[model samples]
Target: MTEQIAHEPLDVLRLRARRRQAGRRSFRQALMRAATGIIGEIKIASPSRGRLIDNARPPASIARAFEAAGIDAISVVTEEDFFHGNLALLSKIRRDTRLPVLRKDFLTTPYEIVQSAAHGADAVLLITAGLADDQLQPLLSEALEYDLDVVLEIHDEQELVRALTFDPSIVGVNNRNLRTFEVSLNVSKRLINRIPRHILAISESGLRSPTDVIAMKQAGARACLIGEALLGADDPRAFIAACRPAFVA
Candidate 1:
């Protein structure tokens, strides 16, 4: 029998785990909350379990559909292993759409922030599960200097407190737990009340239908980051358009 091989480094895994302890706030939390539109998250991950259709749509094609649906932002996953995303793809998507682009990656160091800005990204995703609060603040300030938005992603209440320390303009409650990789819509509902009305509150992960989007919005999510469901659809634009009537015009 062949032995399983490790793909990610132990140090990288350690760095990601350490982020839960260093709580901080971010400036972008407010903008995300104030946003009146959806934030379309793009990913070209290895196919999901039991996937029947092999014809996953190209990133650009999907991005165009997102733009047509009037999304507030576009987040391109740059991680390669699980998501099969690339930084170069982000640059490509940026050239194709007027919407603000967010580089979604497990960003650990300052160099990565510079790389994101240089790559033509308008924003960067800093997960609360990936960086210490102290480590996150400086990076937040630096990204701001470049005029890039910073969206902080947190998994739970502890992470939320840490996220708040940075005073984020947008704070996303990712329903997917990094450790367990489980998702629940209630995650957004549970965290919404704790966040001030001034900050933009967003729900990330596991949002599937129009009903799901509405539920999230009612739970105080200014916007919802949707990807898998849209990308999996036969016509992403049509599906997204169908959901538009529910949001305030």
Candidate 2:
């Protein structure tokens, strides 16, 4: 899988995991109290679930609906092989949507980051498990230099520690395990407590209902990158509305 690769040695993962834990008061407060943002996503397919749309609407149209739903951000998956997503979709979404657009893909190189910027991405997804610290450091630095926000994704305690080495302000705890392609809310519930303050926390994948969305927030996620469930819904607008009630005053 593109999500699983060894750029950093195994010892690095072990060593980083050994670093100081982040269960401080300030950290816990940041996770629990921050106002949550909604990050709706666009993708026509998935490697694990097959096709998402029978006749996919144009990226611009999808972005328009999501914007109308009052989502805080837009995530456009651009992985061509598995998701059938493309850079053109991202560029088109950027042009159509007033919201910030995040380029979600299996980014492994600095080149992909550059492409994300050139294509009108306001941010990019970087999975810690996909690249080593040696590669992650330079690529992350380059993304910032390009003025693109980085959504650093991690799955477990080890990956979370490894991700912290870069001092990212935005973190994504994916509920779906990339290696096994299994979905579970426990992943985020278990890992969210470890993430500290001043950083925006996002829970990604397998969020299927309003209750699921609320649960993620209570577990310390400040946002969610929702795609599949939203795409498969009978009423995308209604579903989006439901996911946000817990966050509303």
Candidate 3:
């Protein structure tokens, strides 16, 4: 017989736990007040390395490079299962820099939101694909109470519609399809017209060069969430800085 697997109600458990821990903190308001531009993302290698393993860069070095390059924000992956990230690494990055740190995780409940905010994250990623309509308000509410900026991410049309339901301040269009793992820049461009102009629009995934930034800006994106390209570079910061329009000019 095939081995059976046991699963816990992680979402339910986390939601209950977060509700009990709720207290005023202020990440959302600060994020809204801040500028959304050129968010440099830091990704750790998974324990099971992929084809990009040869280019792994330490988080410290990565953070320093991005800072020197003048990035507006920094995102640290805290997912351990697939991204090979650690919460400890995020804490270290947070303490080391003044730039707003975004906790780039699969945030599912208020508990995870509180944990991120309390740990010094200025922002948190909320994927529309992972949440339902009824579940979003509670999570967003708790995150707001903790003063965390929410980067609501969507992968497609349906998720985009769901994301708009919250009137999010910051919206990220992820090019990577969560199911097939395929990436296409068109994802963000396709959804751009539908997004409200007042909201800070971010393009994520498949962004490779400064040209990509130009294209995205022209397509109406205010910012881009880049991970693989920077992580794959020998000089990550320089690569990101080079992508800046001012630097290029």
Q: What does candidate 3's lDDT look like per residue over 1-249, in tens digits?
A: 011112324454345435533442233343334443677788766433453333454676678777777677788988877887766788788778767788998877666776676566778898888888888899899877656778899988888888887999888899888888888989888997789988878889888887787788778887777777766667765766566662232
> What are the per-residue Cα lDDT tens digits for candidate 1 across 75-108?
8988877777887898798778767788998987
The most accurate candidate by lDDT is 2
Best by TM-score: 2
* Model 2 regions lying over 4 Å from their true place: 1-36
Superior by lDDT: candidate 2 or candidate 3: 2
- Which 10 consecutive positions of candidate 2 have the poorest summed lDDT? 20-29
Q: lDDT of each prediction vs. the true structure?
A: 0.73, 0.76, 0.73
TM-score of each: 0.81, 0.83, 0.81
For model 2, how does the per-residue alpha-carbon lDDT over 1-249 read when each residue is reduced to its tens digit?
Answer: 233224434344333323311211122232235344777889878776788766646667877987786677788888889899888888788778677778899888766666566667778889999898899988888676556778899999999999887889889999988999888999999999789857788899989887899998788778877887777677767877787666753
lDDT of 2 at 37: 72
The residue pairs in collision within model 2 are 8-132
